[model samples]
Target: MSTPARRFDTDVLVVGAGPAGLAAALHARARGLRVAVLDPRVAPIDKACGEGLMPGALAGLRGLGVTVTGQPIAGIRYLASGSCAEARFRAGPGAGVRRTDLAAALSTAAQDRGVQVHRATAGPVTQDADGVTVAGIRARYLIAADGLHSPVRRGLGLDAPVRGAPRWGLRRHFPVAPWTDLVEVHWSRHAEAYVTPVGPGQVGVAVLSGVRGSFDDHLAAFASLADRLAGVPGTPVRGAGPLRQRARRRVAGRVLLVGDAAGYVDALTGEGIAVALAGAAAAVDCLARDRPQEYEAAWTAATRRYRWLTAGLLAASRVTPVRRALVPAASALPAVFGGVVDALAGHSDGGRTTSARTRWHHLEGAR
Candidate 1:
């Protein structure tokens, strides 16, 4: 006797199983929606990032039931050619975790919640108002959580809302002592590097800003820092080419876009994972209320202004004189500069104190 064909149905379908995709899956499940997640990778997708989650991200991870593995970074450290400053808040926390590990953890959490996940080499998604048909499975709603170059976003004919200036990033892991408990951004004429302690004896370095090269070449400049790695050899390196910060409109039309697919902010701020996770929750909220239209406004309110602030900062980094003038001034007044940093870190709700924060030095430090 022949067996009857089986049918698979779900409330929502998510593409790409990265942090953004996993977050969306978890959120959708939390909202009582049956979810299906598709990705090309098996469990964890290796990503090149600074490995630091801002406070905003910490909150998002918790909401999604994803747990980080290290002590929180209390604040951020800024370094310029001749000046260095640190921003610390009594309440904020920053944690470090490898991207692959974080992705695996979140993916597992999503699965435990009953989300149906598929790992396929390549099977494009065909989405419509009724559902998304991939291979043979169907889902009522589709979500695009793919990364910067998302095929789902392209298929939907949506463009990124904001465009980022050209910049490249080379990421590598080195066995080195902790430079500081906080994430550190070191700026130079050629490039800028971000250092974070992700493991007990491991630190991740990401070089962004100028010349594009391999991780080995990128670490050459930080000789003093590299020396620490001699005792503990360097691990394999990963790199992401110049990133473009773009967000899309119409994320939901019987569908939703989360994480890098919905929008991407410059990595200079190191808040991409947090944004993706938070965006996922917001998308789920809209879908639960039967108002997918709310996602655009909600996500924009959450991330657009932050993107603008990063643009100003990137521009500020371009001019040597401006950078020189701003560093000392910013360092002298922590409250002023730190507040702006905090805002960029996603502490503030609506009003951005960029000007107030940036010009604080001109107001009080010039004297």
Candidate 2:
């Protein structure tokens, strides 16, 4: 007798409960598809991040009927070597949300939409032409939003080698009122510190650097910022490492990768949430139309600006002189700086022209 074939329990199985996976689940459910999400962690997962949502990210969340409560961020401010350059968002203000708060909001929205959430790790991914299976659950398709070091992607043999020095991030929350509405980027010789207000009395500080050290060691590089936060009560440090991750391809058999799992250049531009949401929407759209192959091109188009711009800036930052002169250069050339900021904010023509709906329609028409 032949072995029995697995039956799909859900139309889509999303591996991971982070923003990307949850967003994919919600999108799939909205399209009338049965979706189930899996992750070992419980509700309201926390991670180390800058915690500043750009205008486009905020808009995407709102479109999903997810409301995140946090501080309103008006602009970006780059400070280095006693110089500062600021660029206010022209479209709208973003938000400074804590990771846990954002996760809770997404989770609540997913629950309200009737999307199933399973608190179990995806043990292994096995896929065929018909469907994929993981954690003993079978589904027509699998979305790997397992984040920077996604096991799903690795298991599928889609992991790509990343070149250059690896960078890491450390984040902590301080009990102090924000001094400015702008999300501050404090640049030092070997690291960059991001300060975003997550609440009326709470601010998050994340430091990114190629060199490994304690959070305090990284903070000490920014003398003025350290002084301001000195003696303030702070939450325990959280971290994520080797910020740059690459995938050989986003699709493998019946699986599609979204968010950081798809590929990541760096967090320097802070476009992670917006890009992840876009990728999630695109993945669901492609799956709904039975055109999973189209997802690769769509995701590439959606993240072109982020990948290029972030890669360029990251390369420049690796150089000592260029890193030291970044803020001063931006201050000197306000137009150029503002243009770059707007591009990263998802307001540029290349970044905003193709909406997820438009992509889906194009795919549908192609079919």
Candidate 3:
């Protein structure tokens, strides 16, 4: 009663051609599985993001045989009115490429590796003992990387509602020469603006806050940065909202969820791409082993770091007194701030606490 292998359209059908979906297609094809990826749009798509790739993210992309170009980011810097702390990446530098550049590179890589590219939007999914079918293609297994508002997730009853006050992101690019190698985060009472050098003569600024007004209004929150790009020509603003999404379960039947479709937290940490790529690899690995259920656990472990860190930081960022204390505390204990930034950069596993600092320094400085 076995169906002929040729009868199947693909071994794995991935919906959405964004970085996560394309990454999944490439990874699946590498394992010798026939893969097809579907998307509703053409290549070089753009979206709102912090756009700073941490060192780990850059390395992961190269591992999948992808090469992209952008400005080199050496580290991260946090600044407030009268407080500042910074850290340099101990692993290596990360790139700050635009979303369009990344999408183009990934699309080319997927085609080069022989992944079937379908330019169609996937509709309601129907599955049986044979497999899952969507948009006329019958795939033995399905991977949904369709993004935050995934129709596949909804059709499959996998969506989960998130609580708390919603936060959103707004981003735009400015044509101005880079001033620093580090990605600077300018925090204020109402918003946090991330300045990423995306090219030698262009920088992308993203602001995160409770739903806000014009980009000019958000830019004004960062006084010094606002002054530098006062009238610089910029790209049209792109945005994403309420900033959090989740799934009831990552794996259900022969289908698995990846990227924002699987779940998402606030983008305050800039780890979205890295975590998505990891989930893509993990989901494909499960299919390769014919143990699709194991992907749930794998997904959990893969995203544990991002989830915990973003959650804790976001929760702290919400508290009035604690939020007010952040920059001052970071400024007072510069070493601790460096450690946290290094952890975020994938240098230390967030395990190397600053308590390791020698007491001799304290005594010497006291004298």
Candidate 4:
């Protein structure tokens, strides 16, 4: 007698409830797939992040019928060693949204779309030729958007060794009026501070550093920023570590990895949300086409520029002289800097020029 076949609870099972996971659920459901999301946490989950959504990220969120309201960001400003370089978004304005607010919007949207979200932890993923099973739920495909230190990825044996210094992130909110619409990136010798205006009277400060220290210790490195935020009422500090995460591959049998689980470089470019959303879309598209193997290449194509640019910047920032000269270089070549910023914001001119322009932008940053 032949063995009995397994029954599927849903066509797609998405692990993790961050922006990437929720986006995957929404996309799969839109494609007429019975999607169910599993997460140990409840709705409105917050994390330490820059909290600035790029123009493309905002567009992606709108496409999913998720609306988030926050302060409008027109551009990015880089300040280092008494010099500054700023560039406006050629495509459109981005937004500075709180992580909790963004999560609430996505959760509501997912619920309205009829995507079933379960509050249970995923464990012991077992997949056969037919489907994948985790936590008593079986599905045709599983998406691991479980984040940088994804247990799912590790279970699937996809974790790759991360080289170089491990950088960490710390974030807190200050109850003070925003000074500018541009997201300000202040660079110090050992760390960089990202200040984003999430609301009319609230600004979020996120510090990225390779060294371990308290939030105040990291902030003290930025004299001007510390002085500006001095004596202001602030929220409790939240933190995330070793920003550079690597995965061996995005696809493994009936399972696929998305978001930070797929891989990550650094947040220096502030492209996390945009990249995660794109990855979610690509993964679902591949699954909808019944071609899970195609997801790896699709994800690579979608995020090539981001990976190259972010990795190059990280490499440069590690060197002392290059770190000191970054802002000045951008200031000296204003047009080039603007082009790079536009690429980072997901602005494309189309055709061969766009490809060539992107290469030039990447080369400039790499040098």
Q: RMSD to native for every prediction?
A: 10.1, 4.5, 10.0, 7.8
TM-score of each: 0.85, 0.93, 0.92, 0.93
lDDT of 4 at 300: 92
Candidates' C-alpha lDDT: 0.70, 0.87, 0.85, 0.88
* Model 1 lDDT-worst window of ten: 349-358
Error of 3 at 265 (Å): 0.7
Identify the superior model by TM-score, candidate 1 or candidate 3: 3
State the TM-score for model 3. 0.92
Comparing 1 and 2 on lDDT, the stronger one: 2
What are the per-residue Cα lDDT tens digits for candidate 1 across 1-367?
0111133377777888888787777766665567888886778788888888887776666655567787457788877655878887555777878888888788778767788887763266676655567656677667778778777777767775444347778788876667678887776665677888887777888888656666666666656545555556767777775577454584646777777776554687787876676677677777767678787888887676667877677778777787666667788887988887787565332221222223323433554
- Ten consecutive residues with minimal summed lDDT in candidate 2? 347-356
Top lDDT prediction, candidate number: 4
Model 1 ranges with Cα > 4 A deviation: 1-8, 160-165, 222-232, 345-367
- Runs with alpha carbons beyond 4 Å of true place in candidate 2: 1-7, 347-367
Candidate 2: clashing residue pairs, number: 0
- If ranked by TM-score, best first, what sequence of candidates would result? 2, 4, 3, 1
